[model samples]
Each structure stands twice: as C-alpha cells, then as structure tokens.
Target: MKTTNYDIIIIGGGMVGASLACALADSTLKIAVIEGREPPAEWPADSFDIRVSAITRASENLFRHLGAWEEMQRLRVQPYQAMEVWDATGPGHIHFEAAELGEPNLGHIIENRVITRALRQRLREHHNIDYRCPAHPKGLLPLIDRAQLQLDDGSRLQAPLMVGADGAHSWLRQQAGIAVAERHYGQTAVVTTVQTEKHHQDTAWQRFLPSGPLAFLPLPGGRSSIVWSTTAEQAEHLLALDAGEFMAELGEAFAHRLGAITALGPRGAFPLKGRHAKQYVKPQLALVGDAAHTIHPLAGQGVNLGLADVEALAAVVLDAHRARRPIGALKTLRRYERARRGDNLLMLDAMGAFKSLFSNDTPGLRELRNLGLDLADHAGPVKNLIVARAMGLDALPAASLATS
Candidate 1:
C-alpha cells in the first residue's frame, strides 16, 4: 500500500467544491481542490452580485459547522421570515411563515459570490486543504487503486479519491463515463434587482404565471431579487426592454403585488436546464453538487441542493475514514449516492410537475391548481408539512413510509 501526496483531489472550487474543502478542513486528510477560475474577491457592503441563493436551514447549519457562516453574516445576508406564493392567472395563494414552525426564520437570501468568498477565506487557514486556482485537468487516468490527474499546466497529481464538484457540464463526470438526463424547460430565467413602492416586509414573494414563475426574493434596502422564468423569446424581448419599460412590464406581471416597481437593476438570463447524472460514483471517482443533479430554480433550491450534497458527501467520506476504507471505493461512495440520489430526484420531479401544472393555461388546470392552493392553505397539517419541507427540517421519507 502507498500513500499519495493528497488523500483526495476535488475539481471545481465554486460554492459546492469550496464547501467540500472547508468541510474536510478539520480532518487529517490531505486534499487538493483544482479550479480553473480565480477566487472570488471580498465584496463591498452596497455591492451585490447578480446571482443569489435562498440558503435553507440545512445549508446554513452546514456552513456553520464549517465556520464559514460568520464571515457570510458579517459580509451580507438577509433573513426572510415569511414566504408568499400565489398563482398569477387566478386567486390561488398560500403562505409559509417561520412563526408557524416555531422557528426564528425560514432562511436567508445570500449572494453566491459572497458564499464562495467566505469558503475561500475559510480555506486560507486550513493547512491540510490546498486551493489551486487558474488550473484545470488536461487528462485523467483511473488506475486499479488510485487516480492520476494531469493539469493543463503540465503538472501531475495522484490521490486515492477524486470528486467532481464541477457544475452542470461536468468534465470529470464525462471522463468517468457517467450518463446524465437533461431536460430543457424551454424557458429562461431573467434575473435582476428591483425596488418596490412598498417595503418587502422580509417576505419572499412568488407568483406562477402561464409563461413561468416569478419570484421576488427580499434583499436589503427594500430591494428584491427577481427571478422571472419565461419563454426564450419573451426572455430575449424582456432583456431588451429599457429600464423604464422593463419596470412597467414587471409591475404589470406582478400585478403591483408590492405596490409599483419603482426602479430596476442589472438584468441577465440563463436557460433553465434540469440535469441529473445517471450514476454518482464510478470506481475511485465520485460526483457531487450540480455535477450529480440540478433542479429547477423556481423554489431557489438549486444551490441549497448543492450545499446539501457537500454536507452529505463530507459526512460519508469522514465515516469511511473512521472505518479505514478507501474513500473512493464504490462501496464507500455508494453510501453517499444512496443517501442523496433519491432526494435529488424527488425535487427534480416535483419541480418538473410544478412547471407543467402552473405553466398550463387550460381552464381545468387553472381551476384545479388554484383550488388546490387554497385548500392547501387552509389545511394546517398539509401547510405545516410543506413549510417543514421547505425549511429543510423535515426527515427524508423512508422506503417503508413512501411505499405505504
């Protein structure tokens, strides 16, 4: 038996990859993170990135466990106490509140860069984890017991375990011959910041329309981060609209929910593509985060799901370490795959169903979904169940419970 310079080599150093590195910081494992891009810089108070995520309680706990939560808080975070959801075509509306669950808050709206920056900052003090930036794989070689990675810089590294935390178009997943199921929703999400005439009241607002769903995520200073999912054609046109016209159309789409839209900020659009790798592990290689699965952003659960992947993978690896098993063996990695694959698939299917149900303008579906929403609102148990699930405090349904 031989010990490599690194116990594990992880590719991708964004939020999820960085998270995995941070999670392993306290361990004795010698890990190296290979990333092609430069690390995120510290952000100023008033500056917010175009990308943000609704960090769930589960993810928050993971960040806390890794000691990155404090830096994130000190930099920026907006804790929303309530969530308001409704159908735009009709009167179907339901709400989730933190008080109902006896929790202090549902979650926080955090900038994506801020999180990566914090993770990178935390990695600075971790002597065991090496952060390699402006680097990528030129080649990968999987041996009988270990893997060799050749970087673009003509450098070589070997490890007993390798992880692909690289996002949607994962190079490592492809190299491992993993299959993926990808579905394009035929919609693009247009994201931007806006000012409402009325205060956000620390609540997240969303309205499902025939085109897609529109979310008004509360930010600081009465501003809200809006994610409008709509057809590609409409998304192009919407992005073309000047600030004034765009603001007008936004208010109309939202029906002036928080009064009129007073101002608009930078806007960008991304095609909504749902993806899931057929297998999370192959021999000494494993996949995590977006590399394994990507969900609809309507619920702002994409990043949350990725962070959860980090947490689960980290736990499985640590447990394997305690058992003195090769961390990347199929036997060791399958535990993580089994723990996460089902939950990830469930969320993907649920979001796809919601996309189909709410995007249809059929008279029957319109009435049926609206009625369902109202009924769900009045059903305390059902509503509580939903809130619990959204807060990530609910337990995963066991096979017995699910089958029954």
Candidate 2:
C-alpha cells in the first residue's frame, strides 16, 4: 500500500475545494485534494452548462484572490444590469438597478462549468497542492496529534486537519459524526437554457407563481437560463415533456417576456430541500460549502452562500496558521462556525417562509404578500436596504466577503 502525508487533506475537489487549494497555495503547508471525480477540463468556447449561478461582488473578490476570476473572465460571463421581480396574482412588482447602487452591475450570471474549469486550472498550477483524482476516503482514524485517512485504493495519508467540501451528502461529515437538520421542500426545480427571439438587455426576471418561483436569468448571446421550481408531480411532468412541448409550456409560464422562447436544451430536475449541519466542526474535521448547508434556489443564493463559507473558513484557517496555532484546533474551528451559522440559518428560514407564503392558495394571504412587495417597491429606504443585502453589500460580512 502507498503511504503519503500532508498537513491538510480536503475531500471533494469541486469549486470550493479547488478554491481553498488556490487560497492556501502560498502557504508553507502541504495540501492534498482527494476527489472522487476527475477535475473538469477547460470548457470549449461554444459549450454551455445548464447550471448557472448569480455571482455576487463578494464572491468575485474571493475568486480573484484565488486567481480564478481572471481565468473565468477570459472565458464567458454575463453581467446583469437590472432585476425585475413580480407576483403573479397582483400588480406588485419590484425592480433593482446596479446604477442606483452606484455600481456597474448587480451581479454576474456565470456558467458552472466555466467557474469549475477555471478553479481547477488554478489548482493545477500550484506545486504545493497535490490533486488526487478518483480517490475516496475509506475511513478516518483520529489520533491525539493528527488524523489518519484510509483511501479506497489502499493508500494511507495523515493530516492535522481534514476538510469536507463534498456537497450535501458529505461522507467526511458523516464519518466525523456531525448531525444535520434537514427538511424536504416537497418541490423540485427544473433547469434549462433557452434561446430567445429577442435580446434580454442584460436583465434578469423572476415571478412568484402559485406553484413556486420561476426565474429567467439572462445569459450572453441572446440566451437565458431558467430555474422553475414546482411541485414534484408538476416538475416530473415538465421534465417528461419533449423539447418543443416543453418550450411551449415554459413560454406560457414566463408570459413570453423575452419574446418567443425557442430551442430548449437538455432539462434536468433537482429535488428542493434545505439542509444544515448541526455543527460545522468536529475535532480535526471542518465542513464547507454544501457540506455545511444548502438553501433553496429561489433567491439564486445557493452557490453564493457556499462561496461565502469557503471564504470565511479559509480566512480563519489562514489566520490560525499565521499565528502558529493548530489548524484543526476546536477553538479555531468554532470561530468559523460562529461566523456562518446565523447567516445560514437566516437564509434557510427566509426561503422556507417564502416557499410557504407563495405556495398558499388563500386569497387574503396572497393579497397581503403581494401588497408587501408593492410597498417595498415604493419605499426608497427599504428598497435600498433589500437590494444592498441581495448584492451582499450592506451587512457586516465575513472577512472573505468584504469588498476592498
């Protein structure tokens, strides 16, 4: 059996793990990324991913700090200048503009593959980091001073700290005995990209329907991506639709705002749920990204939240290392948990409230919620506050999310 050693081991070399590797690249510590799948290669110029994210300014800063943003810019990203949100039942609507906030753009709509490829490219350039593909941790053996990892390929490695960035079903988190609070939303999101007859003008649109929220995020080249969340049966039926019929249904749902919608790509559905680890750390192990928590996609904040987690955890670990403290010390890990828990719980709760509020068929409740939106739209101070919060600008954010 092969034996290796490292100062730290990060499981799941996805976006967050790769970003962490780049952040720690300059450190003297030895790092290893244990990945179950091969890292993504550079995307072809014309390729598009169905999955996309709204990247906030803070998330962009973290990617820049890790040297991945430059690569992403070289690839493809669409900057959205405005956002329009409306409720289906009433004339309640709200609009946010980047210009109003004295910024060039609110956020960017970026393809998931582009970001993943860029991060992987950055990771490849770091000599201090070891990229182990098609690797899985067989088990974790805790020691007084360090922890031992037994890999599926009959390899042994030891590290003072192990990070689980392994998505919602994190093996490391489970192995470390971390409990998670989970709730099923009884909904599913159908995602796809569509070509529109008219240009989107770099604006994103969202509508709250009786079933769920449907969002059309503008993409470059006169195209847009859709995230339509609905009840399980509806989602299944939509997914089962043929390309032409599906686009017809989508056009009706979106009210054909971008003119005639045509040419639907492959459609995929993901069950909607909220999950948060009861604790973020245990002894020598720490969880980040989806491993730590997952919120509803209604606000388009899922990846942004995970990126925030990455940024905060990275700063805490780096600061501890600079101070010559144990990187895996429980006291140090507590700082990370403290910084993220409240914000994560808030997002989860807010999404839950929105889901329940919109899903109700009661006329009175619908009127009240729509009226609330109308009121917020006319209230300058309240509108500014909400927009700032959505852009990740107003709150006293974690160090990683702080803009310069």
Candidate 3:
C-alpha cells in the first residue's frame, strides 16, 4: 500500500473538520482531509434543507475569519435579532435582544448544507490542504511519533497529529480505543421547514412542554425552521401523520405563536443522545466536535461547541508548531484538552438538567421553573451574560492563528 504523509491528518471533512483545515490556511503545514461522503454541488434555492443550525456570533466571527461567511450569506442565512423562551406549563417567559447584547443580531439560522458547502468551498482555496472526498478510513493506528489512517483503498496516511471530527460515532475515536459515556434522552428531534401564517419576525421562539421543547427559528422569508423534541413514540406518531394533520398538531403545540403552518417541507427525525468521550486527547491524537461531545439540540449549541473546539485546538496547535514543539505530544494535546473538555462537560450537564427540569409535569416544579424564568428575565445583567455565552463571547475567545 502506498503511504502519504501530512503534518496533520483530519479523519472527517465535515464542517468542523473542514473548518479546521481552513483555520490553518496560512500555515505551511501539509494537511489531508479524509471525508467519506461529499455534499451536493448546490442546493435548490426554492426549497430549504430540513437540517439547520443556529450559528452564534462567535461562530460567525470564525467563519468571517476563514473567508466563508460572505459566501454563506450569499447562499442563504437568517439573522435572528431576538430570542423568546417560555414555559408552556406556566406564565414564565424570558426574552433576549441583540440591542441588549450590543451586537448586530443574536445569531443566524442557516441550513446545514449551506454551512458545509461554504466550508468545503473555502477548503479548496488553501494550497496546503488535500481534500479527499468519497474516501473512507478503514482503520486508524496511534504510533509513537505519528498517528496513521488506513483508507479502504489500501492507502495509508500518517501525521504527527490526527483529529477525530467524524461525528458522535467517530471511527477514529473507536479505532484509537477511546471510551464514551452516553445517556439516551429517550427523545427524538423532528426537524422540518414550514411557512407560517405570521412572519417569524426575525426572532427565535422556544416553548417548553411536558414532552419537550419546540423551537421556531426564523428563516430568510416568512418560512421558519422547527425542531420539535419529544418522546420516541410521539415522534413516530408525528412522522407518520399526513401534512395536514402534522401542521395542525404543530400549530396547536406552538400555540399558533406564528399563526398556522400554512405549508410544509420535508421532515427528518433523529434520536437524541448525550455522548462525551472519557478523554479528549491521547498520544498523537485529539478529538473535536461531535466526536468529543454531543448535547441535546434544545439549545442549538451543538455546532457552536464544535466550532469552539476548532478555535481552541487550532490555536494550541499553531502555538506548538511555532514553538517548534511536538504538536502531537501528550503535553501539547493536553493544552487543547484542558481548554475544551471542562467547557464541553459543563454544557452537557446543563442540557441534561434543562431536559429534566422542563420535561416534568409536577405542578410545584412547573411553578418553580416559571418563577425562575420570570426572575431570570428581570435579572438583566445575569441574563445578558448567559446570552453572551451562548453567542460564544464570554466563555472562549476566538482562536488566534498568529504564531505566538
């Protein structure tokens, strides 16, 4: 088998992996990005993708830094100015505005395909990056001085550092024998695009129900993207419903906040699970994105968390390279681990707590949460801080690529 060498071997070329490559564009390091599947050349402009993400301002900063944000905007993106969260069980509600945060807008609602496409396009501009699509890693080996990946075609790639950005079921993580702790939320996230009777008003709305949270994220037009988290049985029921019935139920659950759902697009559902690796780094290896941790989508922090990993890992790796230190050394990888592991765990735990707190129907618990929401709404400073964190401002600063 022929062998190829790279300064870094990224085992997945999804958004996170691809963004990492772009983040290191100015570096002289030779990199290889192995991706199993390739995204479509272009998406239909008239229809929207069912899979979408709420991109925080910090994430937007990273994309802008990478030179992909403009293209994404050209393709399609919705800038949501406000977020409204309420407890359906009580009269407790909280709202956050971009003006309060001293920002242009809170975040963006962009299709997953749009992000991937834009990142992929950016990947092509970096001369140091070798992107291999329709390629799968058959195996991975962590060596004393290098980590190696064996593709199904019998080609091998070696690098001082290897990254597992493949996803929750990370093949690289599994091959390297990293253990993961997983908790099934026993809920499924049903996602789709819909046209609302009332415009979404460029606002993000989430209503907590006994079953789970239903979020309506604004889109470019009067359309909105919805994520409905609910029990498995109920999810199946929702999926099985015809368009009319589903729209009726959806409108009712959302309290017609956006008025009726006049039109429906394709629907998708995936099981929700919280997974965190026992360790984020090992000799000659590191993990990022869903490979490192996954949280419930109720908060839409999944991709933001992944982008933060990209920022931190890129910074540490660039720093190491400049210092002429071993980028893959355990000591060096640990820096990235230390910077991200604690934060990821904190988010996972918080999501779990929110899931438990909102999914309960106890009258007293409902009242307490409603009161908590009320208090939080009135607590301006505290609320702004929380929203800022969500915007990726307060917690982790954007990654710096300048040689330190």
Candidate 4:
C-alpha cells in the first residue's frame, strides 16, 4: 500500500473538522483532512438547507479569524436580535433582547451547508492542509509514537496525532479503544423550513411542550427553520402526515405564535442522544467535536461547544509545535482535554436537567418550573449571565486569540 506521512490527521470534514483545519492554517504542520462524502457544488439559492446552526459570537470570531466569514455572509445568514422562550403548558415566559445587554444581536442562524462551504473555501488557501474528500477509513493502527490510518483506497497515512471529528458515532474513537457514555433521549428532532403568516421579526422563539422543545429560528426572507423534538413515535406520526396536515398541527402546537404556517419545505427527522467519550485523548490519538461529546439541543449549544473544542485543541497543538514539543504526546494533548472536558460535561448535565424538568407533566413540578422562569426573568444579573454564556462571550475562550 502507498504510505503518506503528516503531522496531523483529521477524520471527518464536517463543520467541526473543517473548522479545526482552518484554525491551524497558520501552522507549519502538515495536516490531512479525510471526509467520506463531498458536499454539493452549490445549494439551491431559492431555498434554505433544512439543517442549521445557531452560531454564537465566539464561534463567529473563529470563522472571521479564518477569513471565511465574508464568503458566508455573501451566501446568506440571519441574525436574531432577540429570543423568547416560554412553557407551552403554563404561564412561564422569558424574553432576552440584545439591546438589553448592549449587544447588536443575540446570534446568527446559518445553514450547515453555508458553514461547510465557507470553511472548505478557507481550506483551499492553506498550502499545508490537504483536504481529501471521497476517502473512507478502513483501518487504524495506533503505535507508541504515531497513529496510522488506512483508507479504502489501500493507501496508509501516518500522523503523529490523529484527531477524530467524525461525530457521535466516531469510527476513529472506536478504533482507538475509546468508549463513550451514551444516553438515548427517546426523542427525535423533526426539522423543516416554513413561512409563517407573521414575520419572524429577527427573533428566535421556543416553546417547551410536554413532549419536548420546539424552536422557530428565523431565516432570511421571512422564513423560519423549525426544530421540533418529540417522542420517536410522535415524530414518526408527524412525518407520516401530509404537508397540509402537518402544517396545521404545527400551527396549533406553536399556538400560532407567528400567526400561521403558510408554507412547508422538505422535512427530515433524526433521533436524539447524549454521548461523551470516556477519554478525550490516548497517547497519539485525540478526539474533538461530536466525537468528544454531544448534548441535547434544547440550548442550541452543541456546535458552539464543538467550535470551542477546535479552538482549545488548536491552541495546545500550535503552542506545542512552536515550542519544539511533541504535539501528539499525551501530556501535550491533555491540555486540550482538561480545558474542554469540564465545560462540555457541565453543558451535557445542564441540558439533561432542562430536558427532565421541562419534559414532565407533574402538576407540582410544572408550578415550580413556571415560578423559576418568572424569577429568572425578573433577576437581571442571572438572566444576563445565562445569555452571555450562551452567546459564548462570558469566558472568552481560546477562540478569541487561538489563531493569533
């Protein structure tokens, strides 16, 4: 088999892996990014992609630093100035406005395709980065000093560090003998784009029903992308319904908060689960993105967390390389793990608690949650703290300076 060598091997070319490569663009390290499938040359300009991400400011900074933000803006992005979250069953509601916090906007919602397309564009400009699409990993062998990956083409690539960004079901994680703690939420997220009778008004609206939270995130052109998390059975039923029937049910469930659902786009569904790797690093192998952890989407922080991982890992790796240290050494990689594991765990637990608290129908619990929401709404300091953290501006992680 043909053999190639590199300083770093990144598995998966989704948003996370691609972002990591871009984060390291200034480095001299030879990097290989392997992705099994290639994205389309272009998406339909008239319609938005069903999958979208609520990008926090910190993540936006990282993209900007990588020089991809301009192209992304040219393609399309929707900025939400405010957010409204309330309980569907009770009189509990909380509103967050960017003006209240002296920020221009809460965050921007962009389609997943836009993110990947932009990142890939940045990858092309870096001479040291080799993005290999249409390549699948067939085998992995981890030695004391390096981990070797065998692609389906019968070619082998060896790297001092192998980073897994392959997502929740990470093949690299499994090959490295890393185990994950997983929780199946027994929920499926049904996603689609729709036009409402009322304009979204640059706001993100979410209602926590007994089943799960339903989020209406504004898209450009007065349309909204909806993520409705519900029981697997209910999701199946919802998908089985005709477009008109589904739109009617969706309108009723949302209480016509945006007047009515006037049009529907393509619909898709995926099961929900929480997963965290038992170990984030093993000698020459390390994991990032969904390969490290995945949380419930109730808070819309999953991609943000993954971007933070990229920033932290890039810092440690680049710092070590500049210092003439072994970037793949366990000690060197541990810095990335230590910086991210705690934050990721906290988010995972918080989402789990929120899901438990809001997904129940107990009368006493309902009253308590409503009261808690009211109290939080009234508590300015507490409310701002929550929003700041979600916007990823509170701690100011390596994302702000990692590329510098």
Please give each candidate's TM-score: 0.95, 0.96, 0.98, 0.98
Q: Residues 1-404, candidate 2, lDDT per residue (tens digit)? A: 76688988999888788887777777788999998886356545555789999988777877877778888898899999999999888887999998987899998999988888898888889899998888898988998868999999889999889999999999998898889999888899999988888888899999888999999999888889999999999999998888888989988888888878886468889998899999998878899889999989988788788877787777888888878999999999899899888998998999999889987879999899989998998899999888887877754334543331
Q: For residues 1-404, write the lDDT of model 1, one tens digit per residue.
A: 33246888999998999988888767799999998886457545566677889988878887887789999998889999999999987899998899888999999998888888888888778999888888889899877789999888788889889999999999999898899999888999999988889999999999998999999999888889999999999999999999999998999999898998865458999899999999998888889899998888998888778877777777888878877888888898898889889989999999999999999999999999999999999999999988888877774311111111
Query: How well does candidate 2 match the true structure, expressed as C-alpha RMSD?
Result: 1.9
C-alpha displacement of 61 in model 2, angstroms?
0.9
Model 2 accuracy (lDDT, Cα): 0.86
Models sorted by lDDT, best on top: 4, 3, 1, 2
Model 1 misplacement above 4 A: 1-4, 395-404
Q: Return the TM-score for candidate 4, rounded to 2 decimals.
A: 0.98
Q: Candidate 3, overall lDDT?
A: 0.90
Residues 1-404, model 4: lDDT tens digits: 66899999999989999999988878789999999877666867777898999999888888888788999899999999999999998999999999999999999999999999889888888999999988999999877799888999888999999999999899999888899998888899999999999999999999999999999999999999999999999999999999999999999889999987965578999899999999999898889999999888888999899999998889898989989999999999999999999999999999999999999999999999999998999999999999999999975755535546
* Backbone atom clashes (below 3 Å) for every candidate: 0, 0, 0, 0
Error of 1 at 94 (Å): 0.1
Residue 247 miss distance in model 3 (angstroms): 0.3
Query: Best-fitting candidate, measured by lDDT?
Result: 4
Candidate 2: segments with Cα more than 4 A from true spot = 39-44, 395-404
Better of 2 and 4 by lDDT: 4
